[model samples]
Target: MAAFSRTASLLCKNAVRSESLGKLNNFCTSARGSKSYQLVVVGSGAGGAAIAARFSSKLGKGKVAIIEPSDAHYNQAMWTLVGGGIVKLEDTYRPMASIIPSTCDWIKDRATTFKPDTCTVSTQGGEEIKYEYLVVAVGLQLRYEDIKGLTEGLEMDPMLVSNYSAKYVTRTINAIDKFKGGQAVFTLPNTPIKCPGAPQKIMYLAESKWKKNGVKKSSTITYNTAMGVMLGAPKYAEVLRGVCEKRGIQVNFKTNLVEVNPEKKEAVFMKLETGETYVQPYDFMHVTPPMSTPTELKSSPLVNAGGFLTVDKYTLQHSQYPNVFGIGDCTDVPTPKTAAAVASQCGIVAENLAAVMKGGTLTRKYDGYTACPLVTSYNTCIMAEFAFEGVPMETFPIDQGKERQSMYWVKLHILPRVYNLMTKGWWSGPAPVRKIFHLGLSKQE
Candidate 1:
């Protein structure tokens, strides 16, 4: 009881000091009475939730606060299967209140602006959250409306689908089911998406579905991507290319989606090679929209020219502000954004952020590790795990870039379990599994 009072008093003193000394105009007056905290985490998704759990557990009551707008938390990772009609959308979401640890204060408001210099954040409801240290895990914002006619087409019948958000993922399955013949087009947007392989993954699932429905002979499938290769890394790309060839999946490289004329059932694409525009008629279109950093973060001084948080790629610490750090898709780190990557970085972030709070040098570092479980069909997947350097960093010793039933099983069954356990501060990365599998072999060999 006494400890709680002491913590509350400290928060009050800081809140008063922040308003008086900093003279932050953006802060809301109502929150001035609620007291300030030492650490404030913005967003409560994968990266935010995990780190919040770690920090709140370490800091105890009144020390940590999470600034989130959503009432529900979701696993964006599993949306691929949801789009494939393998899993229901309802299975992907949970109440945000139930997941965040009891030790932290939950501010159910969107951060309208960030004043990093003063360590103050203003909310939509006119509340001010003052903190000594800040963690930015706001994640990316999907820009579906950026594509011409995409918004209207997506909302209407004969819906052009997307798996990027909960609102639209169900459309992917609907489009696939309705396709009897003609072009079933799937696209990869030019922007950085959370799961780079997801666009093609759904295409494979649709192709498999077409075959199952006995429409394979009549239907034509196409995967148009802006990227030069099927994947970023060479090792995995080699395997993925083979899969495309074997599956008879049409691959169009450097082709980007620019517009959708749903009334005519036409999709317009820009060819990077010839600078030519082409319109193709489609029976079903699965669109992957452009993405960018959240509005508030992009406008702040914290983000770079690319509209992503400028953090040290290895340390997950802000380039300019030592007290501020970022993890997940929001950061300008040169790693593929995925929930698997967020999971691997959580321990490093938790340890390093704690060190920063205690006025200690950062002891832990986050390698640009990301894992993508490439679901090829309903019952098969290729688990591709790699780091920044492009050496295969698989947890299992066997070849990981190959399609396997076991990998599919893991993706459907084990991965979700690990996600639930890990988010609650239980599981770390697969470092132990890696060590156990490769006892004799050198990391390089």
Candidate 2:
């Protein structure tokens, strides 16, 4: 009887080892030219990097993967300051390997196609990546080629510049410095952009610089925007409109920049309301080129009619696929596309995605909290914080709609440090601080 018991125990051990080996063999055969992970995050921007860091800490090494093509991760918010010559462009970015969590596998490749139904992502390098869960944070693409003569204008004309691209951002400061006196035109594209307030921010900064140099008396500044209002939020719009009026800056509403003549220094504008076309010659022009969702996303089945990810606005989960999620400017979240918005959405996406992985209910909800620091001058800013449908969501006890030097200090000094911490998943916006400052009276979703 003792011999029989020993043999039975040996057989049970062998059976367990055989089953494990068989499963390993099957996985190896199925994934011959592909890699697999528990979680895969696409794009290494604000949203992708933050969420990847969060899960990398939770799931441990080799369990998470981040797909990105760029070598550096840029703090794009600093580009505004860079364009204004307040911050160096080199100071805004870090090595991609340094910013990405050490535990997560970094696939240095662009995601060519997303096959949500098959639980796989094909890369430009001819490799397929399978993931148990996926996060799509691929941000917007700048379409400078969409406008005729715009691409050539950026390369050939020294007076024509844009704050939108790193390649052209430094040219903005150069153009501002070179301008003596003439019509200085700033344009806002008709498409949804990364930061809607940025075009105007640079305009204000350039105007302020000109005033300091006594160039303002001779120069005429014009803001030609396609939007019907100065800002989406009425409270902040009123303040911004007042700033423009006081500074004597002319604003043309419902106007779109259609074409540029680099040789003639001419800009063609179309009145969106009437289809009337007009030509305006400028000594200096800042073009915020039209932008759109990435081509890969536009062709994917995961997108809505507007070519944005079809995610539940509150939960940040993909509408059709429970295992898939989205964040930042790529999603159909009805809010301004700012880094602050991405920071607020990070925690919600991380929590809700974890719940989905565990086969549990998604308890966390995003409140559509987005903030845009409207830099009115070199030392003053109107910090506009709001929720969905233009509901004011102020963080400070005092009014945030007014232009304040204190807020400008925060934007220039504090926000950059906070942004670095956020990419590491250490910061999740100012919601808790807002609660404390507001003495628990702040709005909570």
Cα lDDT of all candidates, in order? 0.84, 0.88
Strongest candidate by TM-score = 2
TM-score to true structure, per model:
0.91, 0.92
lDDT of 1 at 115: 74
Residue-wise lDDT of candidate 1 within 382-411, one digit each (tens)?
999888966678888788988999999999
How far out, in Å, is residue 132 in model 2? 1.0
**Residue 40's C-alpha lDDT in candidate 2?**
93
For 143-246, candidate 2 gives per-residue lDDT tens digits of 99988899999999999999888789988898899999899999998999998999999999999999999999998999999999888889888888999999
Please give the RMSD to the true structure for each candidate, in Å. 5.7, 8.1
